[model samples]
Target: MKLLRAIGHLIITIFLTALTQVGGLIWLLVLLLASKFKLKKRYLFPMVYLVFNLLLVPPVAKYFGREQLPVFDKDLKPRHYLYPLLFRNYVVPEMKTLLEQSAEHLKYQSIGITYLDANFPFLDGFPLLPHLSHSDGKKIDLSFQYVNSKHQPTDKKPSLSGYGVFALSEQNFTSNSCIENGYWQYDYSKYLTFGTINDLNFDSKNTKLLIQELLKYPSAQKLFIEPHLKQSLGLGHMDKIRFHGCQAVRHDDHIHLQIR
Candidate 1:
């Protein structure tokens, strides 16, 4: 079964790679025509980056470093299914190692990570919905390990909404977010955060350990979590642990770890 699944994933990935090539060419042609009419040169490089990916070299372009995105380790189960095929979970070597090490540590506690947005295979400017800073493949969202009232590990995913302390009773997975479907609008209201009340809440020890593990990586740049969480965890470093601060969506359910 494992062999069959691996073969299936490979086939689908190859198909998507071909599709990206075609899509990149189409975008390039459109951009070229737009450029002929003396359109702004601003979007030129970004468009070229997309085209380069669609061409023979679909993973890296001059806009980005030569190091292409690496496929994630199978141990990290994706909270969102299409993430694997869409290549949104790819990461640099350093980040991947950090996550692997983190996973190893979490396994002793019987916990796992929920992988989220990486970036489109080729486009830097191309938007990956429900995110503002993930276009560069350096940013990733992951669910906090949820624990029961006794603080024991549970089968549940992350929880909490909006503010961490204030949003104890709310849930976030109400979104129509799914793969194997056509176009659909995103339900931005659904999200998880710390301080989720009732039978389930974010485990402080596990969450703190996750953050500490991420910070261990030398390439680690910043961590975007809610303000209240930093205080609750007694993590007061302004340099690394920065607050997203109501700029876009509330990151209560997941922490955004970005690397240099």
Candidate 2:
């Protein structure tokens, strides 16, 4: 039983660490304190975690050259609230400025930029899992604009997680080529999308403008998206826009932006 309990703790530590960079250590601390203080483990865990994230992580992260993305900023925000709490919203100061400026440029058009998993705080090369390249604070994922069934634009994402729900073109050249080459996990994000707005359609016009605005910044290095989207959006001439390669997952659902 002692060995079994040790294994359980190890598994939880790894899982929490993978999901939230600092969570494993905090979980362990909570485990020790909860037993000593006789507090309810179930409730104490989240309460302590939330307090740590809010009071400690952000300030410490800044000292290491990573700034946490704003959770409620009107110009730029995370696709899900959990992103900030999970410490998946940290980025270099320049990258944050680039995103905010791009969003501000599109503010007149009512095109909001909703970001997804970025690098974790406190580590320069610690893998963010599922997104290996996002280890650095220079990379981030942005959700593309989508419209409801009535053809009216909405902030509501088709997928609960703002991932998956691919915006496929009539001919999915890049997607097919990647899958045909034996990369089975290429389109795996589809499963991560908890059933949400199934009828939402990709808003090409707004999404195109958003990309264009982002590319206007000199600090913007490269934007990885599927080739079909580049052709459809008429962004073929943009030098900063490039294919992410088959090694990474498809980018038809969101734009992967990186800075110099």
For residues 1-260, write the lDDT of model 1, one tens digit per residue: 98996577466545544433234354445456666887653466446545544453534443453233334444466654445444455555566667777777767766676666665555555556556667666777776766777878764554333223322224322221221132132324353343344567767777777788778777889997666677677788646998664445555556789888
Q: Rate the local accuracy (lDDT) of all candidates.
A: 0.58, 0.89
**C-alpha lDDT of residue 179 in model 1:** 13
Error of 1 at 125 (Å): 3.0
lDDT value, residue 52 of candidate 1: 47
Best by TM-score: 2
Global fold similarity of model 1 (TM-score): 0.58
Judging by lDDT against the true structure, name the best candidate. 2
Tens digit of per-residue lDDT, candidate 2, span 1-260: 99999899999999999888899999899899988999987999999998888988889999999998889987688887889988899999999898888888888899999998988988888889888599889999999998988999877788888988888655568788888999888989888887666678999999999999998988899999999899888999998999888888988889999999
